[model samples]
Target chain A: MLRIILYSQWKWSRGWLLPVAVVGFAIPYFMLRVGYSGERYWDAAGLLEQVAAWGRGYPALAAAIGLLVGTSAWIHDHRGDHVYALVLPTPRWYYVLLRYTAGLVLLAPAMITVFLGALTATWFTTLPAGIYAYPIQLAARFMLATLLAYSLFFAIASGTQRAAGAVLTIVGIVVVTQLLAGIAGSDLNVLEAAFDRITIWPGPLEVFVGRWMLVDL
Target chain B: MPTMKLMLAIAFLLALPWRAMSGQAQDLAHVIDSLRERVSFWDSAAGYYDSITRADVDTVRVGGFAVITNGADLAAVEDAVNELRDRFIPIVGPDTILFQDKYFAVLGRGSHVVTEDIILAGLITDNITSQLHDAAQWYFGSETGRQFQSWLGPRVPITDSIAELPGIYEVIVLSPLTVVQRCHSGDIDACGASLALGLHQTPEEALRAWFNAADRRFLVGQLRPQWDYDLGRRADQTDGERRCIESESDADCVRILAGLYRSGMDVEAYAPGTNFHPSLPLDFATHSSLAAVALELGGDGAYSRLITSNALEPEARLEHAARASIDSVLRTWHAWVLRAAPPSVEVQPRSAWVTLFWVVVTAFLAAGSSRWR
Candidate 1:
């Protein structure tokens, strides 16, 4: 059953996996090279600016991998009307688990690539004092972010089109409510309050906040 | 056919001119020239404004004459001072009347000191002193003042007791002993007045006054019920440290005290002083005390407003802005600061190499696995 699941995931995503892996590995190495080369004459401020600008790429990579992997996971099933999956001699939960596990397994290589890239980047650079490189931590964060994106997208893809529409509608309602409150000139700091609630302590997205410093105190 | 060809040629020729005109209009050279002119104008204006604002503040700070009073009133007095050289000193005609605390101090040269003294003597006549003192006694003798006087009595004696403690000499040698002696002898109002005056005499006296003032202010500012406990603990720690010092180790005590003084001075150096004394304006130390007092009184709003209004002039604002911008740029300069791995002193190239090696190997294995399936 595991073999069948792996084969199916591979058949669906093989075209995208190679390019993404290469790009993932190259990102950290390229960033390090450019950053180090600029470090000689550039002051700490300039260097940090350049590094933060490049840091945006990590989230982008995670989201892309998630979206692509997720879309692929459902594409074949959708094309075949999901008839083959429903006919399988297993519970729907088992099928979903198998699919999720397979996608995670495939995601491991890209995660490894990020880790390698970060490690290599750290190895080559001469970090300033009071700073530490956390390649393992960076890799772990990248993995978690990727997994989160993948899981979210996978859940969306697995749902009926109506379910996806309902989720989008709820998001739209929240955004509209916030926008109206802003236009009404009420000191209704809904958006900022919502953002703080979501990004601060106890929020799922809290990990992304604070400092993303690869080398931090 | 020839007519059609001519029409097409004319249209093409007209289009060329239009495109050229648009290109010329959009030329970056013109934009750069305009930007340069605007920036130059702004830069000149900013510079002029900065200088004018600084000059205005300086003039305001030294507008009045500060008569140096070194009597009993000079004991433990804390006040801000601003200085001006003789050449730019404003002359209030000799016959002009000046009120204490109302007019700013203008320190003039010794050449005119005798003339200024004669003028000031006429202004602060005995009649005025007696009148002001009587007014103060009357007000302070009233129910409100009596209540305050009674409330103040216990606190003053406690302060005197603290000042008279044997180790007080280690902190402040002159004013504390004089103040304690004065207070112990039942000259309560005089003692209070002396302490206030001593703080204004010199920077050192001002600092000692400021230290005591800060502790008192801190205690008053704390809203928590446990603040007393916290303050007591802090006081105990300070007392313990003071008591631990051996009188025989005066040199060591001096060194330690000097270090502590330097730390306080350093903080003051970054702060702004008040405009009270003409000959010697408050130094960084005095300014820091004032800033601390402002903060203790009203929190960050008071502190920020005082510094912004009194200390941060146009020139200082520009300097601060430039510093902040540069600091921000430095913070983001390194991708190195973003590394997720715990850095070791020695670079570990092995982890990178191994990871890369395995990634390639895994990719190939994945590819091969797909082919087999």
Candidate 2:
């Protein structure tokens, strides 16, 4: 039953599996190629600032892969009104477990690809004197981020239509309020407030805010 | 006429390279002469042995590097500093160093010139001194560093500055022989320290005892800068800000610190932001006072009063915080043997193996997932 669930999830996500896996493999590898100049003057003031700026791409890629795979996990179930899921002879929680486990297992390939990519990226290159290549740490962080995003989007997609609508409404209200504040010459910036609320420490979205550095001092 | 003009132009072109080459030659010769002069001065001192100790036997707590000049061009000092830096920076991280060069004048009219006590003629700015103090801290307790045990066999252990010192010697006075021996063996900070042991002896006997490693009598007096920041003089000049005054060799600078502290100035107060340029505030006033105060308080349980007054302890005991602060100050003094010594650690590539191992383990785990479910 678990294997069947894994197979079903794989069938759904297979269309983009190759592309996402390739992207996962490429992210850290490309980051190293562009980031390190391996020169004496690499310590010039703004070099680190540039590398950190490029670091933003890692988490974004992880999040995108998570969103795509996670949303795919429940799209057919939502379309069928969860009829097939509810009618399963197994308990509802057991069914959810099977589905969650299957989705996570399907993600293993991309995670493995990232791990391999990170190892390959740092293997041949000599980083600046004090700096180190953290392939394991980087690949682990990417997997955690991917899991976090996948679980979040899965939770949203698995809910009833009304629940999805509620989240969309909240986001829409924030955008409209910010637009109105701009027109009224008021500094009541709802967009920035929402971003701060979501991205600061203790916020769920804070995980994405950390630096996804592959090579660091 | 055209042929003669061509010849003249060709001759002028050849002289241009020759002119530049001669200027380069002159600069090189001058640098060599400056080096020679220093060697000669030290060599002359070796032959003379006298038992007269100067009245001022006190040395700077952290041995100050004095660029001695006999009213000659001071530009040579810049070249010397560059030579020293080029020789050391490759061994240590740049951020871990505080290389501050101040041109202070010596005031006392002395015939012997065996010295350590130099007065900064003008006020010490919090901005630059704080930066120097921060660099001192990096030498002892920066990031996690590797312990030394390699083919090199017993490294100098510069990584942990405190660990490098012989126990008790970090705070207590040792025999003159030990201090002299340490100085002789290339300890730069040891140059002008050991007042308890060296001060009582005569300059000639003391120099012979330590093998002419350092002279505690010759004080460095810094002349104050003429530029007045408060008065807005030289504020816009490119090189005016950091130039320290040459010392005049007197009790005046120490007097100024005592005067400032006596006047109820917060000697350790946070510096004014407008007047300072560091990321954090530094106690410029206390730095001059630090050695003197610590030395005075270093005697048996004297720091207890400070600990009690500051509420660090119910009573001053030499057991913990009091001893710790003294040890810390003493560490600063020991480190002064030279201006900038790097505790170099050879770079290791342990991360590569760690990365490779993880890649294999994770790949194997993923492959086994088919059998697990």
Candidate 3:
């Protein structure tokens, strides 16, 4: 039963995993080339500036990996109305575990792409004194970011469209409330308040906020 | 005969628009003579004048034909050019005066030869210093001022609410120069000193003391013709009145069409209909003092010293402080975005090769399974 479940998940995920792996492998190398396009003397400040500018790509790569992996984890189950999954499973938690593990297993290739890309990008560039490359560290961060996104999206994907609508409505309501508060001059900075609440330490999104330097002190 | 003919032509030229001709010609001739006398001075200053002309000849042309002609003949035309040169002198002469003032302000007085060299050296040094100061002040003083104020007053409080609250003592010492230090130190004494000095001072005195530096800096940076939304609005009103008159005229359609065409292309045709020029309702010094106080309260180390030592008025100090705080916050926010990291997960030694092999195998299996499904 577990083998069958794993095989089904593998089938659904492979379509997305292939293209994502290819793109994922290329992103770091491309970023490295673009960053070092100018003169031979690599000033530390200049290199850091380039790296900082290109940092946005990391989240994007993570998000793409997450969305693809998350969506693939559920598509087949959704298509078959989850009836086979419900009938064959010894327990609901057991079935979910099987699906989760399989999805993670399938994500391995993309994670490897991230690792290889970071390694290649770091290898080609000669960093200034006091700076060191952490290709493994970067790859680890990428994987964690991908997993967080994948898990969140997977949970959402498991639910009905109505659930997504409810979530969106809540977000909209919060935004409108904050904007109106600003207009009213109430001194209640709701948007900022909410952002701080979500992005600060101990927050669910906290991990994404700190320095993600591939090379750092 | 040749000399007589030249004299006759000069007399004729002198007779027509004598006032205009004499003033212009004499000024130009004087400038030419000065240029000849101080060839080195002309060589050094010529590049600066040329740059200004290149930057603003078209805009200057609108003031009058003479302005443009004078600027173009800055290096060439005689007499009339001297008067033209005088105008440029007033603008650049301020730099010399400012240098003198800064030297006097800093060194008090020195020996005659030393003072003279100091004045010259000061001019060059002060020129760069004044430009940087002006750029910073203008950036804080313009529309960005409001944004900075908002960010400082509201956004910062919300974002970093957990940070230590500003003390009353710190609020009092808000001077232009020390604001940076006070903010950095997080000490309240500096803020107290500013508040004590600035809060009740007369507007003019305050302006003289605290706001003058920033004001001078701002004035230096402002481009000519002076952009004022109110003036733009008045121009717009006049354009509207003209359009109405045209509508009533015989060439209404043609005039309206022409006006529309001009409006579409020419920015001057459609002026701004608002009073957007930055005006300090509070005396300059008071504003400076306020900025100084605010900077101390906000803990902005980089700018506090400049703000407090500059002796800005309370209001200017406060305004500048608020602006600096906002700028600092925005910069910090930008930095945060740049520094954000991805997630982390450990991998096996052969993760790359193994993952690739598995991916290929998985693809084949998935393809076979897809057919079964």
Per-residue lDDT of B289-372 in model 3, one digit per residue for the tens? 334334444443314332233433333443453445433432332233223322323333344334334334433333223211
- TM-score of candidate 2 relative to the true fold: 0.40
Query: What DockQ does every candidate get?
Result: 0.02, 0.07, 0.08
Q: What TM-score against the true chain A does chain A of each candidate get?
A: 0.88, 0.91, 0.86
lDDT of 2 by residue, B184-279 (tens): 344533423332222313333433333222121111011122346796753332221122112332233333323332344332231322111011
**For residues A1-217, what per-residue lDDT tens digits would candidate 1 score against the true structure?**
9788888889888898988988888876766556554221112333444555666787788889988886687778778887887789876666767777788888999999888878887887876433457778777667766776676677677777766788889778778888898899877876677788755554444444433334433
- Lowest lDDT block of 10, candidate 2 chain B: B147-156
In order of lDDT, best first, we have 2, 3, 1
Q: Whole-model Cα lDDT per candidate?
A: 0.44, 0.46, 0.45
TM-score of chain B of each: 0.17, 0.24, 0.18
Better model by lDDT: candidate 1 vs candidate 2:
2
On residues A126-151, what C-alpha lDDT tens digit does candidate 3 reach at each position?
A: 66443567778777767766766676
Off by over 4 Å in 2: A43-47, B1-373
